[model samples]
Structures are given as structure tokens and as C-alpha cells.
Target: MPKPLFGMAVAFGLLLVILLTAMGSFALFDRLDPPPLDKLSDLSVEVIDRDGALLRAYTNKAGQWRLGIDLDQIDPEFIEILLTYEDKRFSSHGGIDARAILRASWQLLSNGRIISGASTISMQLARLLEPRQKRTFKAKFWQMLRALQLEARMSKREILTAYLTLAPYGGNLEGIRAASLAYFAKEPKELSLGEAALLVALPQSPEARRPDIAPRRALAARNKVLERMATAGIMPQSEVMRATSKPLAAVRHAMPQLAAHASDRLTRENPGALVLETNLDRALQEKMEAVLRDASSKLAADLSVALILADGKSGEILAEVGSPDYLSVARAGWIDMTRRQRSPGSALKPFIYGLAFEEGLIREQTRITDSPVDFGGYQPKNFDMGYQGDVTIRDALLMSLNVPAVALLDAVGPARLMERLKRANVSVTMPEGSDVGLAIGLGGLGITLRDLTQLYTGFVNGGYVKTLRDSPAEASALAQATSNMGAPILDRDAIWHITNILKDAAPPQGAAKMAIAYKTGTSYGYRDAWSVGFDGRYVIGVWVGKADNSAVPGITGRSAAAPILYDAFARSGLTLAPFAKPPLGVQEQDFADLPPTLKQFKLAGLWASPSPVPEEAPRISYPPDGARIELSRTALGRQMPLIVKLQNGRPPFRWLGNGRVFAANGRRRSISWTPDGQGQSTLTVIDAAGRADSVSVFLQMPPSAP
Candidate 1:
């Protein structure tokens, strides 16, 4: 072989050996000392509104406000300025810039001190990941190596994101998002020139130049960034001058805390979620919160207010203020009143009237006695303790006449009313060990403000109740599906009648009339004051009370809560959506023009005069003897209530189930009772005239019983 060829072969062999050794060393280093990325995932949980506006932020386990953000979420100008100020060669460098390092070294040697930083964004991110307490040569060497590894593993954008996310901005705030929100009370998506410069300058010597602590130093640092921008021609001189002229924000604004209770609940339900997106409107939530705060301040001490505003059609909760001030210890503001069940006073009257309408027992124009009357042993009086002698059903409901409502509930059956409300997905809870009675129509039962608002949505949405939801994802799913709507609370015609009557109710003083159909309710002893109203599109429910369940004397629902409801509607900045057209089979008529059966509402064996002589003996008309009846059962196999009717029964009948008295001395011929167990049972009824009837029936469980 030729001598020159041999020499070239030797050189090539040496070069290949060196390259192989370098590759082996790189692989070994990566396996032995990988980057710590677990902390990067420990970002602060954020709750945002429907349009992606921050409602609240929670610190991470480390007690740092390090919100996760991407490039798209940040302003492009801020990115350009940051890149220009931090690393001009960031885009072209592999991880470390050779030119910058050489320049920095030359400056240090020439001045005997550090002049400029040679660390790229990647190196800064490495230092953040494995933070060092002090600057040392070993730390710098490891950071440079980590930077190289990061460049090999992550894209430029990812490195930039990690760096910015972990960049400290004094105190507990770590990241541009926290700094922007804390300093400017806004997001970093659209930052001003001065704001951008301040943010860029914060990461370096963050504690020394904190804007909230040292305004003068912060201002100097921010001006330096602006000057650099001008020198680098990244920003025009005029803009740089304007930016420098702006004063630094010396005080940090509190982070957004809108919908605090709702956010808290969502975060608890969805633990480990980085971002929770709800259906709330930030502007409306802020406005309603302010209104409640202002209104609560004027009320008695320790009295708190809660409000909820939702879209009637979609059931999306736009605003939910659980309390006037979530931080007020005097008000016990941490309690979420919206979810606390309390007596709803007469706010439930419309449903009773609606049930009566549904049963063909009465119409809006039907005359009903509102004077004091006894329903069995349960008697209810009007809130004002004064009653109209005789009034139309519309007028009775408008006035919220308790006697009239209880009478209607007696005819409708308290169990049946509760059943209808349950079908509408409105939760109603009776006091422990209390039987269903007429007094429930007059605020004897308990319901939450949220459920009450949901119940009223049925009236506005043509009788169908919309299940209230706050999460945007859930709302979107609901919009695409109809299975969750469940059954209507009332027939369309009945709901229309109810809506027509309620819309005419007098508004609180200083409030506009005819804007909405509203009802006010004051629980017993003024422990709870409630006003729930609905326009064509929105439903707002307000609750005012002491968190400890103490009474506020002289505080009535119409006086306390109705005004807030009206103010909420006015400040909602929404055009009044027109009510739905009257459903089919609905008619407007005067009292004298109605049918005879529909003109007067009379309770069986109570309101109507009894016959002088018995027409026939009492006989079990339903569940005929020796018949098999299919009854509905709950998931736990408990039998649901059954309605039994008799052909003819005297007043105050006694009903027995399997020799056990279930209902004693009931006046109505039709009665509802729940069977204790599923098999053969004998139901007997004894009338006032000593006439008795008995029937044996077999109850079969429903298909869904478990």
C-alpha cells in the first residue's frame, strides 16, 4: 500500500475512537443524572370563567403561585422583548451561546468582576429545576450540562415555557402569570409596555427589586429593560420612552377571588386538576358580588347574603355568590348559604297552585277562599296575618296567601306535590320524623337556594326543569343531550298560568315592574329571607340570613331579598328576554266565563257541604280485591307511595295497611300511603258513619328494583 493512504487511515481510526468515547460519556451522563421534572407538574390550580378569565388561583403544595402558561397565552410583544433582553441568540444556540460566553469571560477578565450573564434560557430553567442556594463554579458547570441535556430533550418553546413558569417574581409568586395578576390585576395576555418591561426585569434579583416592596429599585430595573429595548432597536425609542415614563406599581393587587365558594367546591371535587373551567360569566359574577357586598353592609351585623344567577334555558350558572364577603369572619362568610337548606316560606306557593291547575281542579280565575281555615289539624295563616275573604287563584298566588296555598296543597296532596318537585329534580327535605302535611305549602319544608332557583326555572322554561350546572364541560354535554332534563314540574298550560299570575306580582319599592316574574319568601322567625325571580332567559335566587341560623327581627323576604334580586337583574347588563308564548290549550278568560267545575276550587269533604244522607256504602274503587298491582320501588327496594281512591267515603276516614294505621282521620276520599313491604297486604278504610271496607292486594316490585 501507498504511504499516504496508510497515514490517512490512521487519522480516520483515531477520530472514530474519540467520537465513540464522547457518545458513550453522553449516554452515561444522561442515565446517571437526568433533569428533575416532577416539580414542573406541581403548578398552581387555577379556576377560570366561561370565557377563559381567571376567577381564582390556589397556591401549589410548595406554597408558590406558579401558574402554568403556554406561548399562545402570553403576549407576542412581551415574548419578543424578553428574548431581546435575555438572549439575542436564543433561537440559534444549541443550549449555550459560544459568542456570549466568550464575551462574558472577556468582560470578567477585563473588569475583575461579572459584567453580563452567559446563561441561556435553558440554563436558567436548569437552575430553576434544581435550584441552588448560592452561585458557584460547580453549580454553573452543572447548569451548563443540564442546559445541554434540556436542549437535546425539549423544543425551544418547551424550554421557554418551563423557564418562565418557574421564574421567581418575589415572595411566593413564581411565573409571569402570577406576577401579572398580582401586580396589574389582569391576565398576561394583553400587557402594557411598562408592564411587560417590569415582568422581564423581575426574575433577576427578584427579592431585591420587588415592585410591591422596593418600588424605586423596581422602577430603575424596569427602565433599564426599556433602555435596552431601545438600544437593541427591538422597540421604537418613542415606545421605550413612554414605557419608562410610566410609574411602577408599588402595591400588589389581590388576586381574583370571584366565585370563591364555587371555585373551592370544584377544586375539591376535581383534585389535581390544573385548570377548572366553569360556565360563570366573570363580569356578571363580579357585579353581583359587589351588589351583594354593598347590600349586606347595610343589613344587620352578622347577616350574610347569597345569590345565584343562571340561564333558564341552558341551566348554566352564570354567577353564584355564596356570601357577600368570603373573608368576613363576622358574617361567617365561609358558609355556602346557597347549598344550605332552609324554609322557603311561600316561595313554593306557585307550584301548589300549578298542581291544582294540572289536576283540572281549578283555573287562574277560579275563586278560592284565602280566609283562615283548618286543613285537618294543620292550619296556615297569611304572612301578614290578614287574609282576603275570597280571591281568584291568580290573586291568591300573587298575594302569596298562605291559607289558600295550604288549601290547594291539601287538595293536591302534599305527597303528590313533593313527588312532582322530585320529578323536576328539585330536592325537598322535610324535618326529621315529620309527616307530609299542608303546612309544607307555607314554608314548613326545607330547600336550598340553588334548588329553589332550579325549581323556578321550570316555570320560565315552559314547565321543564333545567338541572343547574356550573362546569362548562358539563353544560356542553347537557346541550348535546336531553336525557337529563327529566319530567316537567307542571304542564305547559299550568306553568303558563302560574307565570302570568306571578309576573303581575308587585315589585319591591324602587324596582321596575313587569320585568320579571318573582316570588319572595320569609322563613319562620325571619331566620331566612328568600327572593327568587326569573326573566325570560335568566333565573336569579337571593338568600339573606345569618349563617348561625339566628333570626334577624323584622326582616322579611319581600323587603330584604327582593330588592337584591331586582338589583341583580338590573345590573346584569342583559336585555330582558321575552317570556315564551303561551303554550297551546291556554286561554285568557274572566272569572264568570270559566267552566262550572273550574270556577271554584273546593276540597272534598271539607270545602263542599256534605250530603244529608248517605248515597252509597264506602267501597274500595282502586286496587280491587284479589287483584295484582304493580308498584314502583326505589333502588333500595323500598315501595313508593300509592294513591287509593274510594267510590264513596264519609269525612275523616281512617286508613289501615296490614292492620297498621297509616293514615288516621283523613277527610279526602283519595289518600296516599306507602306499603311497608312488597307482598300481600290488606288495606281497610273506616268512614265517619262506621261504614268499613277492606281489600286485599298483591304489590309487585318494579323492574328497576334492586
Candidate 2:
């Protein structure tokens, strides 16, 4: 019995010693001295340029921020309102207020659960200072202890300031300043009474308080704060009532969120940078976001969109929308779909034309037959379903005809065109035997908005492809713009001509002036819609489609994406920089004799009809040259012949013209042929010596005119 009692006594003594030691150690370490402001976390700030002005702010990985209000743009009333409702003893307390804590503790104990919060401004600041952790009881105790220590070390004003600067309001928005600007479209200091109250109510529940989500709840919370302020005598009762009666109107403005993303991206791309200077106009940025949001909501198809604005001269990205939502669920822990890959649709046509121009396979006015063509089981058709017999390269591209482009592609060879696109950073891996035709011209390759923007730079910057740079200074410092500095990929003249045609392709709609050149691309099955265009100084590309590549039923680029571009330009106030100047040593020509390929199919009227020979009775006046050519006369019978006058030439020259297969038999040059149609055809005369001339002679029907 005595031993058991002694054992109990020893255990009690050990427990007492341990308790005393822990209490002493905590007392010694818990009262922390205040830290200097300079010792605060390494916070960074981003100042964005917008519409000839600056929008200064900062963001975290979660996209939270502190606006420029604490620098005093925010009203003192807002700060006062928040302190009164959130922490009545903000001025008198350090990091923790004992009275509030006790009251909260009593309420929790009495109710058998916690329904009330008693975090002082200082305690909130302590939470902000530390990394995010679970809200466990132990963590709360640590937080409270730390708050007390912070109070012992810092002044009341310092704690309050830190709390105001670091509090998380919602999304990536932190602190009163950021919340004010993001919601009110004004500085915190510029907030009215009702606006101030609305902001004070958000920290408790950001989404619930978000004007976009719950305006009535937000208004009720604002009124609650106003009533508290009036009861505390901080504001007059009449003033509180007036503010309460006024609607709470703090809508989450979309522009700053987009700017934040752009600013953050620019900063990350160029770290340790003094300033992330960009060409983005803030007003324009806001306008673009607004237009996209409105348009997205109204669109019949359930889809998201991505828009990129760049400086045509410098290749600097002015603005970009990675996702529609400020805090998009799809963007979490995944590649930004805006930066992800999408089928380029017809957005790639200009570059294909650029390749043709470079290869000298087609010229602006080269004539091409706009007829149905089938190559090794491959076929292509026009969008209109009716092909133009003949058109110019400029007309075909402007009108976006498919048959002509396919014809040109076949002539120029797809292998060469693929190589050119690869050089432009476009990945074209269509299998080797696939008939490369106008199908390629209509955007059959996968592409990204960034890649498309870069390719367009050649058009805007005098046929020179330059790497995208982060800043204007770097772009300005690039070597003098030259044509094909790496290799001659495109003819300087061709780029010049193509840019001109695209620039005048269509009239600008809405308030936007037709000061830029652009193209619309629609993918097969209506899966992707794109509009890429450029003013003198900037290039803008927009894409709208589903993440799953599902067809939009009947939407096209011209119908959807073009309107977005027009809206952006009008809202951003973008003006024409200047016309793309032509390069030196580049001459304009009639493009005569250029082959009928995808890029040159528009020029198809140059070949004239061939003279036909009357049956076996027809006579020839000169020695025949060996060659095949289309004759103006059409055969109406099984055997048709016409008179031919061929100049002296060698044998074995194939006369290929007028869509017929013809060859020289001997000195007569006239050969009997079965005709598909009895009309004039394009004629050509060739000799083995490769020097034969011909005349257009009429061929009489063989006693039958069917």
C-alpha cells in the first residue's frame, strides 16, 4: 500500500515538473518582439500599362492581391467600417483582443459548438503571415499565441496595417485594397459608403458576397455593417439608413483579373525585371474581357474562348485570356487551354499561300482551272459547292475558295509546302501520300494561337520571321528587318501582295474601323473558329471552340471569331500603325504563265482555246512537232481533226493543253482525236527541239454536229 502511494506521488511530481518546464519555455518563447516592416515577406508588385495609364497591383500563386488602396487611394471610411464590424478594438489591441476572445469562448461553450468567430485584426494578420495550414484546434491555439506574441512585439497600427494588406477576400484576391478595385472599379479610397460596407462583408464569404453570384446577400451584409457602424456612433443613423437603402453594387470587374494574369505571365517570363512593360491598354483589356464574357454567355454553343493581342512590329504579347473565369476550374493544376493546342482551321491559308509565293509556283494572277479534281483517291471541294471557272490568286484567297487552293497545292507539291510551314514553326505532319491540295489551305493542320500569331509576324514585319520577345526594348534592338534572314522562305513581293489582299478581305463591323487586315478560319465539322488579323502595329488572334473538339453544329470563324476581333479593336481603341511596306528588289508583275496551283488558281483565264482539225479530210501546211496541247476546238465525233501550222522543231514534244492528250504523229502534226466536248480549248504547240509555234485554225465537224 505504501509503495503504491509512493509510486503515485512520483508520477504526480514528474507530471508537475514537465508542466512547469513547458509553461516556462512557452512563456519565454511566446512573447515575440515585433518584426520590422522591412523584414516582411518578400512581396512583389506588378504595375500594368493600360490605355496610356498604369494599374498598380500585386498577386500570389493563388492569384490573390492587394490593391493600391492602402497607399491611400482607398477611402478611410472603408477601413473604418471593416474595423468596426470585424475588430472593434483594432486601435487598442496588438494582435489579439482578450475581450472578444472571451466572449467567443463563452458563446462556444454555452452553445456546445462554435458558431461565432473572435479573430482580432492582429490574429488575422498572424494567419496571413504564415503559410496556409489546416484550421485545427491546435493550429488555432498556435495562431492565437502567435497573435499575442505579435501584439507584444508590434504596435497596434502595424498589426492593423499588415492585416489589411494580407487578408484573403476571395479567389486570388487578398486585402481590402485588391477587393475594392476588383469589385468597385475604383480605388478603395474612392469607395462610397455602400461600397465600403459591401467590401467589409466579403471576407466572411467571398463567393456568397460576390455581386455576380449573390447581390442580395451581399447587400444584406453591407446593411448589417452599416447598422453596426451607426450603432457604434462611427456613422450617423441617417447615413447608415441611406447607405443601406442604396443597392450594393460591387460587381467583380473582369479586366483586372485578366491584367493580373498577363502581368504575372510577363513577370515570370522575365524575372528580376525592373518593370514588365507591355503594349496592353488597360481600358482595352477591360473592354475585351467584358465583350468576351457577354458574348460567351450569349453564344448558343457551350464553349470557351481564348484571345491574344500582340504588337505586330515587336511580337510582344499585349493581352491574353487563358480562361474565361477569373478562377477557372479547368485551369487548376493543368495546362492553360488558352495556351493549349487547337486545330488551326483556315487560319493557316495565308501561310500556305506564302509558301507558294516563296516557291514561285504560283503568282497573284496565275490562271487555274476551278474544276473537280481527284488524285490517287483524294478529292477536295469548295465551300460554296459551285466552282468559279477562272479567278485570280488575290480573288481566290479573298473569297476563300477551296477548289482553287487544292489545284495550286497539287501543282506546287505538298512536300515543299510542308517544309515551308515547318520553318514557320507550324507542325504539319500529314502522311506522305496524302494529296496535298486546297484542303491544306483550308486549315487541316493542328496549331496554337501563339504559333499563328508568330507566323503572321512575317506578313506584318516585311516577310521576316522574328522570335517573340517579352519586352519592347528587346524587339526594338533586333537586327534590321530583313527578308528571310535565316532562309528565303517566301518571296518578299508575295508576302506584300498577300498582306494587301487579306487587309482588304472584308469590311470591319461594329465601331471598329477597317484599319487592319485579317483572315477567318473554320475547321471541318465546325469544330474550331478562328480570326487572326493585324493592324499596322499589332496582330490579334481569337479562337472559340469546345475543349473536347466537338462540332458547333453550324458555326464558322467568320460568323463567330470575326465579331470578337472587331469588338476588341473597337473597345481597345487600336489604330492603324501603317501599311506593311514592300521589300526592296520586289517587283509587281502580271503573274502571266504562272502554274495553276492552290495559291495561283485565281488566274485561270490566260490559256486560250485550241484550233481543231477536221476528220481525216483535214490538211496540215507545215511539218508537225511532237507535243500535246489543249486545242480551242472540241470534238463532236469519234474522230476529230483540224488544220495545224507548226514551226520547225524536233520530235517527241508532247503537246499538252486545253485539257486534252495530243501528240505529233509525223510531219502533219494533226492527229485524229475523240472529243469530250465540241467547244474551243486551250492550245499549245511543242517541238522535240522545244521550239514550236502554232496558229488557231478552225476544225469542221465530221459531217455530224451533235
Instruction: Indicate which candidate wins on lDDT.
Output: 1
Error of 2 at 387 (Å): 2.1
Best of the candidates, TM-score: 1
lDDT comparing candidate 2 with the true structure: 0.62
Model 2 stretches astray by more than 4 angstroms = 1-163, 166-174, 189-256, 259-281, 322-337, 426-439, 466-491, 508-513, 584-706
Misplaced by over 4 Å in model 1 are 1-25, 473-485, 607-706
How would you encode candidate 2's per-residue C-alpha lDDT over 1-706 as one tens digit per residue?
6754555555456445533554455566664534334314434355556342444445544454653223354577777788889888877765556567556655555566886787877767777777456987666666666776777777775676677677666777777766766787666667899888877887778777777678788888888888889899999999888888886664677434445555666666777553456666666666666766655644533466777777766666677665455554432312344566666776767766776677676667665566555544455655533345577777778867776666566656666767666665444444357555545666665667766776777777766655454345445433323313555346678788788778777642323347788998888877888888887677888887776677864456765677777777766777768876777765455664343343333423432233433322222232233323322211111121333443334444456446455654443233333334544444565655556444332333322111
Q: After superposition, how far is residue 408 of candidate 2 from its true place, in Å?
A: 3.3
Cα deviation in Å at residue 392, candidate 2? Answer: 1.3
Give each prediction's root-mean-square deviation over alpha carbons.
16.9, 17.0
lDDT of 1 by residue, 56-125 (tens): 9899999999999988989999999899999889999978776677666656655679999888898899
Flag clash pairs in model 1.
none
- lDDT values for all models: 0.82, 0.62
lDDT of 1 at 14: 44
